[model samples]
Target: MSRKHLHVVDSSSFELNIPEAELELMEEMISAYEVRRLGSRNHKQKSVSSDTAVIRSFLTFIQKAPWNATTDDFDAWCYQIGREQKVATNSQRKYQSAVQGFYRYIVDNVKFQAAVLDRYNLRIIQLVTEENKIPHVHERQRTNERPAFTHQDFESFIGAIDVQIVEAYKFNSKEFLALQRDKVMFYSMYVMALRNSECCDLNLSSFRSNPNLPEFGDYGFASVWGKGSKGSGPKQRAVAIDHADLPPLLDWYVNDIRPQYLQKPHCDPNEEAFFLTERGSRMKSGSLNYRFKKILGYAGLSEKGFVPHCLRHTFTTHASSAGMSLEYSKIKLGHEYAATTQTYTHCGDEFVNREAVRYAQSIINRLSDDE
Candidate 1:
C-alpha cells in the first residue's frame, strides 16, 4: 500500500520465492530502503552502498527471499565476507548490522506487513550479537600490555612532552625544533586518536575545510587512509575533531613550528609531510614509538609496553569518558568493527562527570539562546 510498492523496478520476476506475493514484498522492502536513504539529506553513501551490497549478495548467494533466510545462511555469508572477500572484521560487523537493520525495517514496517505476510508466515530476525564479533579482549591486553591511559595520565603525558621544549630553550627557537615537532605530533595524534602510521602518513594538505563544521575552520575532520592489512584495499574514514581547544595548538604547529623542522638542506620544498624528522621525510611509526618512550620516561610512566599505539588507546578511553559514543569512537579510531573500539574504551568517574556537566550546560545555553 506504500508508495514504494508502486515504484518497485520489478513487480515479480524472481526465480525463488516463498510465493509470488512474498517476492513482491521483498522488492517493496528494498524499494523502501532506497527511498528512505535517498530522501535523507545527510545520507551516508558508503553505508548505503555496503548495505545494499550485503542484501543483494546474500539474496543471490542463498537464492532465497530475505524473509526466509535462516541463521545458517547468515553464518555462511559471513564466512564469505570474512574469509573469501577478505573484508575487515569491523566491516563485516557493519555489513551484518546493515543486513539486520534492513530486515528489522522490513518486518516492523506495519503498514506494509499485509503485502509481505499475506501468504507466507514471514519473520525477520537479527543474526549478529556482541559474542559473535571479535570484541573479546585478548589475554595480553588484560595482563601484560599497558593499560589504557586515564585522563589525568594523558594530561601528564602531554605535559611531559611540553616540559621538554620548555626546559631546552626559548619556545620555537632553533633548540626547540625536535621538541616542538614531537609535541605537536603527540597532540595531533591524540586529537584524532590516530594510529601511528595514520598520523605519520598525514600530509599538510590532508587537512581540508569542512563546511558542516565551520567553527572548526579548516581542521575539523580527518580523513585517514588505513586498514589495508585486513585485505580490503586502503580504507578511508573521516573523523571529526572536537575542536573547542585544538585550533590554536594545530595552528601554531602548522604555521610556526612546522616550518622550523623542515629546514634541512635540499629538503623537498613541496614536501607536505605533517610530521617530520630533522632529516625530513615522513616520520615512520617506529620513530613515533621512540618519541613515546622518551616522553613516557620523562613523565615517569613505564615506557616498556607503553607504545605509540597506547596513545590511541588513551585517546579512546578519554574520549569515551568525555561522552563520545562507541560508534563515533570507532570512526575516530578508523576501526572497522565497534568491538575493536570497545577493546580500548575505558571511563573514569572524574572525566565522565566533567563531560556530563559541560554537555548539560551546553544544552541549557542552546535553549536559552533560542529564547
Candidate 2:
C-alpha cells in the first residue's frame, strides 16, 4: 500500500484497510506506552498525542513515497506539508517525533534491523534541523511567555457552575441529564487536570472503587494513560479523589448513572468507556469539546475562554495555592518535568502577600538577633 493511496478519513465511520492485527498492535502500543510513562521522569502528555498523530500520518506518508525514497524524501514531505499548513515550530517537532517513533516501532518490534532504525533516527534529526532553518510562509515572532490565570477568576468560574445547576433544574429529565453530564464533565476535567485526550479516553474500567478507606474511598482514583506512554517507558498514573464537591458527582456517574445508560445490548461489551453519547456510544474528542463549550455557556463562564485545558490550569492553580509541594504537584499532574509543572504556579494575591509578610518577618527577626 503506497502512502498516497492510503485513506485518511475525516468522519468517524471511515475505516482503513490495514491488517486488523497490525492496527490492534498500534493501538495497544499507544495505550500501553501512555500508561507506563504516566508517572515517570521526563514523560510529557502533550508529546504523546502529537507523536501518535504523527505516526498515523507517517504510515500513510511512507505508503505513498517511492520504494527507493531516502531521508531527503522524508525531509521534502515535512517541508511541503508543514509549510503548506504554516505549522508552528512545535508542530514541526511533533511531526519529527512521530516519524521517529514509527521507525523505532518498526525496528524494535517488526522484521526491520536495529541498524536501520538507528540510521532512520539520525536521518530524521538531520532533516528536522534542515527543515527548521528554512522559514515557513508564515513566520511569526516567537513569544516566550506562558498563560496565567488568577485565583479570583478560578473561584468565579466555579461559582458560575453553581448558578448553572439551578438553571438546569428548570429543564426536563433528559435535557437535565445532558446538562448535568456536561457540568460534571467540566468539573472532572478541571479537578483531575487531564488532557483533552485523557479526558475523552476514560473508561469505566479506569475507575476502581474502594469503600473501606477511612475517608470516602468509595470513589477511587482514575488511572490515566498519558501521551508518549507507549513501548518501554512508564505510562500510567493515578489521580487521587479528594474534593468533597467533585467526588459525589463522579461516583454517581461511575456507579449508578453510567451502568444505567450504557447497559443497552447494542453497546459493545468490549467498550467499557465511562462517558457516552445520548445514542449510547463512547464519546469522541469533538463531542467532549462540544459538551464542554455548552456547559461553559450554561455556567456563564464563556467569557473566561474556558476551554478544556483551562480546567487543568484551574487544578494546578488550586493545588499550588493550597500549599502542595511543587514535586507532589508534578507527580499528581503526571508531568515529567518540573519546568512544565512550574507553569501552574500562579498563586493568588493572598498567597503572595502571606509569603511576603513571612519573608519580611524572618528578615526583621534576623536583624534584631544580630543587633
Q: Which candidate number maximizes TM-score?
A: 2
Candidate 2 off by > 4 Å:
1-88, 91-152, 155-162, 209-213, 229-234, 263-271, 348-350
- How would you encode candidate 1's per-residue C-alpha lDDT over 62-112 as one tens digit per residue? 778876777788888777767766776656666677677677677677756
What lDDT would candidate 2 get against the real structure? Answer: 0.61
lDDT of 1 at 360: 100
How many clashes does each candidate structure show, in the order listed?
A: 2, 20
Hey, what RMSD does candidate 2 come out at? Answer: 10.3
Score residue 194 of candidate 1 by CA lDDT.
Answer: 83
- The weakest ten consecutive residues by lDDT in model 1 span 2-11
Best by lDDT: 1
